[model samples]
Target: MDNFLETQLHPAEICVVCTEPFSLSHQPVALPCKHIFGHECIKKWLKSGQGNSSACPTCRYVVVEKRTPRVDFDTSSIWKALCDQPPERLNSLMMAIWPGLKILWQRHPSGNFSITEILDQAVIPALIKTARRTESPQDRSYDPVLDCYNLVAASWDSLGRPDTATGLAIAFVRLARLMSTASATLPKWLTSTARTNRLLWRANASLGIFELDVSWDFIIEATNLEEEQYFPLLHLYTVLVSQSIAHNSQPTPWPTRRHDIMNLVVERCCTKIGGTFWKGKPSNKFKDVLVAVYEELRRYQLEKGKMSLRGHDGEERVVKGIWALAGWTAKKVEVR
Candidate 1:
């Protein structure tokens, strides 16, 4: 099974990361981020588990060649992996999570019940109970979302399930799909993130896990979020160009001709985006970067006679149903 850690079975293919097409001699590795690149090209990028280069070149998702076993059964990392895996790897994932998951798993599949059924029976009710506990007019924290997560983690621990974070995450994902889907009964409660979060938030006041509800507090936090700006347009542009020139040599040299070109292009585009930044709405900068990205890709094609836009993709999200305006932010609110 070619999991995230393994390379594909193809005899020959393009390493989209480096634009290097290698045959059987050197295969590109498929990353957990779902991007493929020459093993060494990606190796240099993820050579350190610390700092900027530690993440996937295109999407900035941190990629680790090897993971130390999580003694604490931490939820975040294990959650991301299990939320996406092949059916055959399910058993392995369960084992990796904890030895006790098998017990919980077996109780469900008496050859009739599905995994979802088991989660709904064993977990959702607990989630609902936890959510109810957190609802209050006086709770305060630097990050309310993190507080909610901590509470959820605590509640899961008391269940005596003796499971790992992976198990909890799997149960969480499975439980979410059963809720009224976004296009159906859930449009009123969910936004970009999942709706099942509030199952732990108490009695369907809002659905889904930490997904944004786009109300007042949500609007304020979104506006004030200090997270360094990320531009998919600039990200894709630089990633495509940078990996196209990565080499396996020790200290894998930076500042190659192509690398420098990528920097210049990104710098130029960012300047344009800054001028057009929507003053208050950081996300609106995407509109500016989109044009800059298209122009850059076009310019590359004109010079090289082959547009290097093969790595580009567009994603569309649907928010169906009448949305329920709910706000969950950790920002301290002034009662005024």
Candidate 2:
């Protein structure tokens, strides 16, 4: 009953097109606008009216589907050779092969690439094979796998493709899980749990819920304020809050209240920087840091309200929340 109530409180998953439940036969298909519908219904709708005028039934946004041809590459020898080698040799092989892969991807006829195919066919299998060779946790080296995944992620990001990056990050997480199960321990350098969580946070920044929550759990587990990693944690927290606000336009149900979230961040920042941060006279250094955070929060809020920036109550609330977090009054901090 509690589970049922929770489901009721949250948005229910249903196909908008056919007004039916999404199942295997009536699978949910996402349009460019991020709205989803029954696969068959969307296909029929696209075929209806002027075929060229096919648009998302929900948002009426024109849907342009880019199809790519599946290219089969014979990477059997490369995989076998890499699996048999040590981490050093594996790294050398990856460095040599990555350039060629990039060139091939660029020269592909379709231009539209699929990261899933690349990872599944080559990268993941190689990583698993290599992992299986190590008898003990200490003997296993994650550098090669981590380096390869990072390279792929960088390539996707450079190509202005977050979607592909997200897929690659997810693939890395799966690879890490596989390795952990095989070795019974995750590598220190890779920090598999925390790193994967961070990747998940990055990958789903646009529409993260479960990923964001899980990322936070790992982050808190991995670091405390006394460490240097605390700064990165702060940045991650800011990003998550900013993204959540922009995406939802209202208080997120998970966090419950926006002010509560900001207060927690503020408390942590104060503890890390110094006890004097929010006390007596605020130091220039502390103020400078707070200003930077405030500016970023303000920028994201404005971007979210780009359609109509005037008299936006939600934006005002966010602005006020940021100011309160820094122990400053609204009048003391000029938003404009």
Candidate 3:
């Protein structure tokens, strides 16, 4: 069998933090926040007998590792890599994320089980052995996209096992927190910040929680003053949508407030961003997701063609299930 870390992978493919070539041999280990490090590093940390107090150097996330014989390499570069790679590395993250996203779009709520297994058994292990430690933030080290993809991978794992959602959510939130802590300490690595910010937002959104007192500070900081206004409403909408689904497998209350927020998101999607956004994107594009959601909501309200423009049910959610499609159609005429 070939060693996993010595394969002829591209330089861009190397994980900077591990100071090793990217390969498919050794297993890659993941921190709770979805950051991938060599299995060896994690093993060494465990052996250090930090007495379960050994935290991720970057996020300070504590994990109890079963220690054995292994060498310890510093993980200080994890934070810097995250901050530095957001812009140039966005495409890489997108590459890995897109594969997982495809799995969601196709299998979703179902194929998740098989996907998680593949990530754990194949992907994670292959990336572990080649890892090297970085002493400083200047390391152009490992692909941050890979780490981000690891986070998304764990997310796929959570869906198959909703019971794990809280743990994954906690990991993600801590990852964001680590970034904040690192940013305050070293301000230079702040280029492609938005990409990671959105990742954290979506992770929290998936947790089905509308209110997060713990996450509020990070939310305020991750977003600009203008975008910050969308925080509370968006968060609320996310939580309510999840709650509207089921409890004890029973449908909860009608999500009135959630529907209202959904309408707002649709309205925002309607705003033409000089055609920069929502063009050729899927129904789930942030610009158009709300409209898609609203259209679904409308189907429940209007009872098909019986809805009228002036009637309460008719006017309220007339095109809810089809709002996003309608919005797209409407945009064509406006553009013409």
Cα lDDT tens digits for candidate 2, 177-234: 2222211112223322333334222322322221211233333322233333333333
- What overall lDDT goes with each candidate model? 0.35, 0.42, 0.38
Cα misplacement distance, residue 170 of candidate 1 (Å): 9.0
Worst 10 residues of 3 by lDDT: 270-279
Query: Which portions of model 2 show Cα errors greater than 4 Å?
Result: 1-143, 146-226, 251-300, 303-336
lDDT of 1 by residue, 1-336 (tens): 548337644453777556778766667777787777888877766654445566788787866434444354444443444334343333222222221223343663322333344343434443333322333222321232233345445655566543332334343433332221211222222322221232211211122233322122222232222311222222222323322322112123434463453444444433322222112332333323333333344444557655333222331010000011111111111121
Q: Candidates sorted by lDDT, descending order? A: 2, 3, 1
Q: Which stretches of candidate 3 lie over 4 Å from their true place?
A: 1-77, 104-115, 121-336
- Candidate 3 versus the native: TM-score? 0.25
Supply candidate 1's per-residue lDDT for 74: 49
Instruction: Report how far residue 93 has shifted in candidate 3, in Å.
Output: 1.8
Instruction: Please state every model's RMSD to the true fold in angstroms.
Output: 28.4, 26.0, 21.8
CA displacement after TM-score superposition, residue 161 of candidate 2 (Å): 34
- lDDT pick, better of 2 and 3: 2
Better of 1 and 3 by lDDT: 3
Off by over 4 Å in 1: 1-71, 77-285, 310-336
Scored by lDDT, model 2 comes in at 0.42
